[model samples]
Target: MNRNLAYALVVFAATAAAAGQAFAETPTLETTPFVSVKTRADVQAELAQHKANGVNTYSIQYNPLKSFKSTAQREQVVAEYIASRDVVAATTGEDSGSAYFAQARTPHSVSRTLAGTPVNTAR
Candidate 1:
């Protein structure tokens, strides 16, 4: 009978400890109601402005560039593309232009005054 009582006491203490830990880990939430910062009229005015600017929020065929007009001629655009072709290729190649940039870099020339050594007095 004493052994059974001690076992029951230990089981009860373990269950109470586990329940207390579970309760401690849970946080009580404070509810705060939302306050509107804009009036209905202001929201309607903004929606009207967006519609006037050709912004269709609910359209399935929305095109942002529908009203775009090109200022450059086709020949000028082609020439610009051709001029930058080599650079674009080098940068986008498998090596990612590291070799091309390394080759293009020029070594810095140090002047006598900045070389931290005395210049020739004979000169």
Candidate 2:
């Protein structure tokens, strides 16, 4: 191969790599509590209180275009809604798209009640 051609190819590869990095858009999914509870008002209200007291926002990291964009956007929008109501603290799926409110924690105990029945290792 010609020396100039080889150099050009190297430059092209580097440029492409840089362009990929520049264009890549990663979606950040941060969970926050949902405001306006009418059905599960009592339970969610308590959860909201706990959230204000400082809780973790389960951040779900993913690529927007190369990964799931819609789901990430949804999560972010929900986060906005939560913020509108001045509620915080949420648990998003680290890699999964699943999202839900995080209730108060009870350490080291496996069992919990979902509605009335005892559920193991979950709140």
lDDT of each: 0.86, 0.63
lDDT of 2 by residue, 52-86 (tens): 95644453643334544464677899878877553
Q: Number of the top candidate by lDDT?
A: 1
Q: What TM-score does candidate 1 reach?
A: 0.47
Flag regions of model 2 displaced more than 4 Å.
Answer: 21-123
Looking at model 1, the pairs that clash are: none
Instruction: Check candidate 2 and list the clashing pairs.
Output: 110-121
Candidate 2 TM-score, true structure as reference:
0.18
Which candidate number maximizes TM-score? 1
